[model samples]
Target: MMTFNARALVPTIAGFRDEVLASRTACTAAFAAALHDTLAAKLDRAVAALHEEAETEMRLAAGKGTEDGDFLYEIYHTCTTFEHLWMESGPISILDEIYEDVVAEGETCRVGLDYTVIPTEQLGEIGGILDRIRRETGIEFIAARV
Candidate 1:
C-alpha cells in the first residue's frame, strides 16, 4: 500500500555546460522549508476536492454490495486520491527534499514524489500544480516514487 510523496532537488552549477550528479543541498534550508510548506497547503486544497468526490462515489455505491461487499470496497478504494495517499503516508518531512546538481540554465530542482495514488481523473489537476511549481520556481521539478 504505497502512498504518494514529493521531494524537491535543486541543482548546482559547474560554470554551465558541465553538470554534477550530486545530491548536495543547493538552496538554503529556510527556502526549502518555505516551499515545502506552501506546496503542502496547495496540495491540501486540491485534495479536499478529491476527497469530496470520493465521498460522493462511496455514497452512490452504498447499499449496492451484498455478500462480498467487494463492490463497495472497490468504490471506496478507487477514491483514494493523491492527497489521500499523502495523508495516509504520514508527514512529508520523511521525504527527500535534498538539492542536486544538473546541467541546466540557472538554478534547478528535482522533486521526487512517492506513495502517491493519483487516480486518472485527477492527473490534469495534479499535473498542473506540479508544473506550476517548476514555472514559479524556475527549477526542474522531478516527481517519482521513493
Candidate 2:
C-alpha cells in the first residue's frame, strides 16, 4: 500500500484548494448556470455528468435529499472541479478537510491520500483532467507536482 505523510501534501492540497477557490467565482457562475438548467430530481445525475466531463470523481460525497443514491453526494468539494461547488455543503467540506489536515499530526492526518485506489480505466480519465488543467491554467496539481 502506498502511504503519504499529510505534512508533505499540505502545500499541494492548500495550493490546489487555493487555485480552486481563486476560481470560485468563475466556477460558481458556470455551475450556477448548469444548476439553473438542471432539474432538482436529476441534480445528482447532472453532478455525475459534470464529474465525467471533469474526468474526476468526488469521494465521500453522498448526494442526499429526497431520494438516496449510490454515489456519495451528501458532502462535496473534495475534487477541484466545478461539480462540487454546486452543492451547498461542498465548499464547507473542502475547507473542513483542509483545516483537519493543517492541524492534525502524524497518523492522524487523512489529507495526504493516494490515488492507487482509483481504478485503472479512471486513471486515463483523470489524466485528461491533468492535461486540461495544465493546458489551461498551468497548475501542476497532485499528479505532476512531485
Candidate 3:
C-alpha cells in the first residue's frame, strides 16, 4: 500500500542540477567535483528509496507465493540503462535525455507490481524519474542481481 509517486523525484533532480550549475565558478575542477558530490548524494538517496520500495514490493509478492523476478527485471532494465548513460554521458546530457524519454514514453510499467499486476503507466513514471536522477548524478546504482 505504499504510494510512490515516481515523477516526484524528477524536479528534485532538476533542482539539484540547477543548483550545481548556478554555483559553478571559474575553477573547473572544483566545479566538477562539487557537481559530482551534489549529484551523487541526490542519486544515492533516490536509489535507496527505490531499493526499499522494490524490496517491499518483492516481499509482498513473495507472501502471495509468487516470484518477483519480473518486477526485479523491470528495475534492473531501467537501472542498468541509467548506469550506462551515467558512465557514458555527463550529468546534464543524460538527465536531459532521460527526461525527454520519460515525456515521450508517457508512462508504462516495464515490470509488474505483484508478478501479475503490471502498473505500466506508473512504472514508466518511476523509470523516468530514476533515469533523470541517474543521468544527472552519474550515480551508478549497483543492482543486487544485475
CA-lDDT, candidates in order: 0.39, 0.33, 0.42
Q: Ten consecutive residues with minimal summed lDDT in candidate 1?
A: 12-21
- Tens-place lDDT digits, model 1, residues 3-108: 2222211111111112111111232465444444444554454445445555655564575557446565564555345434343333333134433346568866
RMSD of each: 17.8, 18.9, 15.5
User: Looking at candidate 3, what is the lDDT of residue 39?
Assistant: 48
In terms of TM-score, the best-performing candidate is: 3
TM-score of each: 0.26, 0.22, 0.27
Per-residue lDDT over 2-27 for candidate 3, one digit per residue giving the tens place of the 0 to 100 score: 33333444456557555444444422
In Å, residue 110's CA in model 3 sits off its true spot by 28
Between candidates 2 and 3, the one scoring higher on lDDT is 3
Model 3 — TM-score against the truth? 0.27
Flag regions of model 1 displaced more than 4 Å. 1-30, 66-72, 75-79, 83-146
Cα misplacement distance, residue 127 of candidate 2 (Å): 10
lDDT of 2 by residue, 6-106 (tens): 23333433443344343343434553333222222233343344445333332322333435443333322234334233322221211112222434455
Worst 10 residues of 3 by lDDT: 111-120
